[model samples]
Target: VYKGLDIVTAKVTKEEQAQAVHHMIDINDPLKEYTVVDFRNKALSIMDSMIKSKKTPIIVGGTNYYIESLIWQTLVDNPKRAGGDDEDSGLDESLIKVRRIDGSSNEELHKKLMQVDPDMALRVHPNNRRKVIRSLEIFEQHGVTHSEILRQQRLAAGCSLGGPLRYDNSIIFWLTCEKEVLDKRIDARVDSMMDKGLVQELLDFHELYNKDRLKKNEEADYTKGIFQSIGFKEFHNYLILSKEERDDEKGEKLLQQSIEELKRATRKYARRQHKWVRNRLVRRADRQVPPLYSLDSTDVGQWESEVYGKAVDIVSAYLDGRAPSQPALNSVITDTRIADNSTETSQYCEVCQRIFIGAQWNEHLQGAKHMKAVRRRRRQEEANEYREAVEIEGKDERAASVEAEA
Candidate 1:
């Protein structure tokens, strides 16, 4: 499970291949969908085979989601099946046909989810259209919010929120470095990628898949497939530039911008990877997830002692059924538990046009927007009551003024 782009596995030397058998590396066509579930199933099969053959299997990768799917049951298997639609298994009608959330703007999708599952909406980044859409789909398909379903799943599994760990005995190693050092390393990696002809690779990829799709007036979504790779989209505009444009001043500026964009994206991705490891995997206190050993990679001078040496020792101790001296990092725990998922009792605010769930409802009550709306409505009610009183009592100017003042 080398969780990386094809370019990464392509760079592997012949000697490396001879050293050990590798699985799930460069196995999927770049144009096709190799989903996390597919990877998890295949990786599990490979691991099982390796175990039976008495060979140790090592799964390495930066794609935390794929690793997460492998280590924990985080995905919803099938909403239809869970909702008792087993009878429609003939032509794959079991799949819920909720309108593609991508059809709407990302903001719209996020806002919609906020209405149904505000807590989930808050947890999921607004820019993450995929997660937002999935949450919305769960709500639309099952008549239950995503948070409610997650709560049910957590309760069933006896885990807080990340779901139950598939392997409680598994040991995870997190290689960490200082932010500035990591950023510089990421910039260097981007430069290396460019030196390796990332531009040419993107051009070839675009010609094969994106060009034809665009010519036929089809969508070339960069959010899916290998296009989601950082370099691919960062260089999208540069790749589209004509050869004539490449020799011009504007082209040079665009090229520089794209290079900087690539570096920034790489650094951002590194931060996201660390955040996932710290927040999702390490913070869960409900059940035994996995023992994560943090290796400080800040100083490359200590690589042998800090990373490789520590990893070898930790693995050896685990194999020997002894506790390793390597201690786990302090838990970076946050409130992952869904405090409330009572969608049935949820109130829909007309002003905000948002659904308020338990604690969120209370918070909404105190929110500035809600308070302002309340004041506005109260003023309107007061005006209406005064008008009614004036009409019924036939009050003169003095009485009306007194009532209004009061």
Candidate 2:
């Protein structure tokens, strides 16, 4: 974001690398593929060099993989290895690289993984070819499964630059929207993209690499990201199939279609994302991960300050070693139909079937039940704060009185 963009280090080119002080973003080109192992390795190297000058690492990203990897490696592993590794450190690097066995096919991949850890092969999916390959590689090089390797890496040595994560080490802020609203947003975003030269870019790139202009199946990789995205694919199909059609008519038809499908697909995607966050991170106690702090994207509106303030609170709580409070993202945005919402009027959330935002839309969200939910959340936060205050301020009269009453 310094440049008002989310261009990651891996996507930049070498020539662009020389223009600014960049790291981690374009270390490899399209000629060379990238893997999570390489990411872990390169990220650590960049972090190490930064710390030598006593600079702070303020990692900010939406990529769960990058964020989780850095947090896991730094917090759980690498306690004693910070000063540099032993002579045998070369073995660790070799084990992390994605290597292949000779004449490797699906069978060989499974067989090799089974040899080291049959349990792992059973747990991992057969079609997860990348993971299966890495499991075998780790086994061959280190005589251990990847999971166990990480286990030992954690145990080997490391001192905490920070304390245990139980102290507000993180605030997993999940931005969300109701299915209908999210879909409309996606459709609108696609319409905006077309206006911003996406069509022209696609046309230019297509002409530059012409093979078959009429081929619908011959989608370029550049368009793959946009096309696979929620609203763009159908619009792209429309563009390709009707190149000679009027742009205004084509856009209107495609946008309407996108509005429908995006809602269905985005709802599913959001559900999956929520499930993953709950299961993989929030539920993993031993992982030192933090609890999620959810915000309805509509509620946040465009209140960047309020959103950022809540985020800062969550982060500071984690850094200060306390659970986060459920701060509101902001006042929610509502449809004009919800203007006269009231208790007897009956409000409903179509996605979750929860009676909500009250009889009047406003009352539904601030109802006794909703308020109770908020109160319960704040109670937990207060308890955590009280405990931490006693620890830090040392036997405050207020804390002592509360403890005595308890």
Candidate 1 segments exceeding 4 Å error: 1-5, 8-15, 79-91, 94-128, 132-148, 214-216, 330-406
Candidate 2 segments exceeding 4 Å error: 1-23, 48-56, 74-104, 150-171, 197-268, 300-302, 313-406
lDDT of 2 by residue, 1-406 (tens): 1121122111344486587666655344221234444566667677667778765455544455556666664332333234333233533544434442523676677666777776666555554566677666656555556656544544542211222332233345666667677656755655555556555554443354335433544335433222333444434555454454626777667655654555466556666666556545544333445555665566555647556677777777766877567642221213121221111223454433453322345765657866777677789889999999877777577688899999
* Model 1: pairs clashing at backbone N, Cα or C within 3 Å: none
lDDT for position 309 in model 2: 75
Relative to the true structure, candidate 2 reaches a TM of 0.49
How do all models score by TM-score?
0.70, 0.49
Tens digit of per-residue lDDT, candidate 1, span 316-352: 9989989788676644345463332323245568877
Q: Predict model 1's lDDT versus the native.
A: 0.71
